[model samples]
Target: KKKKKKPRGSGGGDPGCPRVSKPSDDLQTSRKSGFFSALPLRASLRGYGFCMAALFLFCFGSLFYQLNGGAPQILQDIRHYLGKKFSLPRALPFPSQVVYNRVGKCGSRTVVILLRLLAEKHQFNLVSSDIHNKTRLTKHEQVDLMKNISKIPQPFLYTRHVHFLNFTRFRINQPVYINIIRDPINRFLSNYFFRRFGDWRGEQNHLIRTPGMKDDERYLDINVCILENYPECSNPRVFYIIPYFCGQHPQCREPGVWALERAKQNVLENYLLVGILEELEDVLLMLERLLPHYFSGVLDIYKSPEYKKVGNLTGTVRKHTPTLEALQVLYHRMRYEYDFYNFIRDQFHLTKKKIGLKSASQPPAYSSAFLRELTLRTPKPLDEDEELESDLEDKWLLWCPS
Candidate 1:
C-alpha cells in the first residue's frame, strides 16, 4: 500500500491501523465481566443488612414481651408473621383491647393458654397473669399499678387474677371484658388442692402458694392453718369469684340478692362472656362462633396440654364431695356465691335454649355448621388456593348477632 504514506490525514485516525471486525462486542464483554465481578459484594451487603434488621427486631420483641410479662414464646413468632402478612381487618366492629380478669381455680390455666394462642394468632400483646401483686397493695400502690397498666401498648390482652376495680381512676381506655366462673364448691376444692399440691402438672405454683404453708411441717397440717384462719382457705365464703365480676364495693362480698344481682348485671352488661367450667366445650365453641378472631380451636387447649405449653392443663380427677357439715357451712358462708352461680347457671341454660342447644352436650350450632363448611372447603395436598384461605376468614367473620 505504498507503505502507509498514502494515508489521508482527515482526522487523528492512523490509516495503517487494522480495523477490528467487532470492537463493540469486545467492549460489551468487558463491561459484563466488570458487573459480574461486583455481584458478590452487592449480595454480601444485602445479606448483612437483612441480618442486622432481623437482629434488631428480635431484641426489641424480646424486651417488649418481657416488660409486658407475656407469652414469650408466642409473641416473637407472631410479630414476624404479622410483619409480612398483617391480616387484622381494618374495619373491626369492636375495639381490639381485651381484659381477661382471670379468676383462679376456674380452669384459668387452660383459659390462659387459649388466650395466648389467640393472641399469637391475632398478633396482639398478651400480658401475663401477674396479679399476685394485687393483695395488700396500698391505695398509692394501686394507683401506680393502674397508671402503669395504662402505659402499656394498645390492642393489648391483659390477663390478671386481679379483681375488677373502677379503672376509671386510671382514666385508661375501656377494654372488652371477659371472664370465667366455676361452681363455688369446685373452685374452692381446686384452690385447696392446687395450693396443697402446687400444680397437678408436677410444677410448683410459687406465685400462688400460701404464705405460712411454705415449710413441709406447715404444709402437712394445712387443716390447722385453715382452722386458724389461714388466708388461703379459712374464709368459708369462696368469695373468690364474686369480686371478679363486680366493682369494688362492700356489697360484692355480701351474701345476698344485692350482690348476686350486681354481679349478674355486670355479667349481662359488661362481660362478653362468663364461661362455666362444666360447659367448657360450649364456652370455647361459643367463643369461636362469636369472636372467631380471638379463638382458634380453644378446645385444643384443654384436649392437649402441650398445645402451646403455656398453661398447666391436665387430666381431671373426681372431686371429693366435702362432708355435709362442710357443705352446710360453705353454703351458709358463701351464700352469695351460690346465688351468683345459680343466676349464671340459669342464664347459661337460657342462652343454650336461645342458641338452639336443647342439652348441655350440644355443640354450638354456628360452630358445628362452620366446622363442616371448613372441612369441605379445605384444600387438598399440593393444591394452593389463596382465595380459599380468604374465604375461610370470611366464613369465620360471619356477622355475629349481638
Candidate 2:
C-alpha cells in the first residue's frame, strides 16, 4: 500500500482532479441530476407566462368589443353561451331612420300614439322608447341610448323623448324628423298645474305661493317649470330642454342667443316637421297627407267635454295677472326656439283660422279618451313586455352573415 500511495502522487494524486476522490465523482453526479430535474420546472414557468399573456389578450379584445356595442353575434349568442366564458346580456338594437323629439306636455303623448298607429298601419319596422311613466331621461343616459342606437342596421324608425339636436350627427339620409310645440304661455301654466296639483284637480290658488320657492325647486311638481327654469340653474345642461331650446352641445356657448340661432338653422336644414299642440287635428291632417299609406283615416279625434272648459277661468280668481312677466322671461330665454317654432307654424300653414280653433281651444282631441284607450292597450309597468317583436325580427336579419 505504501508503494502504491507514492505512485499515485506522481500520476493523479491532485485533489482538484475528478478521478482523485470519491467526493468529486459524487459532486459531478449531483450537478448532472439537478440539471435534468429543473428542466420541467423551467418549461412549466414558460408555459404559465404564455397562458397569462393569452388571457390578457382575450380580456383586452372583449373590452373593445363591448365598448363598440359588441360584435353582431354577441346578442344572438347570449342565450347559448351566457354562463360560459362570456356572460353579459346583449345590447338591444335601436331604429335610426325616424327621430322623435318629444317636448313635454306639448301633446307628446298624442304624437307617441300617432307613431304607434303609424307603426301598426304601415307595418313599417319601428321602435319606440320604453318610457311608460317618465317624461325624460338624463342627458348622459340619452347619449348612451343613442350609442346603442348607432349600432343598429339601417332603414328603420325610432321614437323617443329626445332633443332634435342630439341626433344631428347620426348621418341618416332623409330621416323623418317630427316634433310638437304648444302656446308658450298655456304650456307653462299647464306644466305648473300638473306639477302642483298632480293633474287638473289641483287648486289654481297655489300660483301665488309658488314664487316664494326658487324657480328650480318651485316647479318640482310641474314638469314645465323644470323645463323653463332649467336655463337659470348653474348646470343648465341637466334640463331636458337644453338640447331643443338651447341648441346642440359645443354650439350652445350663449344659451339664450345661440340656442335660438341653432334652432332656426336646424329647422331650415333638416326635413323637420312641426305639429302645433293647439292644432292637433290639423296636425293629424298634415300627417295623413305626408304619410298617406300609413296614417290615412287613422286619427280618430274624439272631442271631449272636459276640454271645452280648459281655458275658461271665469269662475276661478285671476291670481297670476297675465303671467306676462313670467311669459316674457321664458320667451326671451327660449327666443330662438319660439321664433323657429313660429316660422315652422307659418310654413305649415297652421294659423288659428286654418286649424279652426282659437289659442283657447280645448285640450288636444286625444287628451282624454284616446289616452285612456292607449293606457289600457299598452303594457302596464312598461318593461314587462317592451320586447318589440318586429324590432327583434329586423335585428335577426341584420345580424345574419353575408
Q: What's the true lDDT of residue 298 in model 2?
A: 42
Worst 10 residues of 2 by lDDT: 380-389
User: Candidate 2 residues 1-402, lDDT tens each?
Assistant: 465443344355674554445788889999999999999999999999999999999999876654333344445355446645576643333223555656766777555555554555444455666543333344655465666665544534565554554554554234567677776545555554443443332464455434355555654433333334443211232222434533435455334556566665676666446767766776766655454433444444223434334423212222232233333344444434444555656755644445343444445322335334433443311111121212211121111111
Q: Quantify all predictions' global Cα lDDT against the true fold.
A: 0.59, 0.49
| Model number with the top lDDT | 1
Worst 10 residues of 1 by lDDT: 388-397
TM per candidate: 0.58, 0.45
Clashes of 2: 3
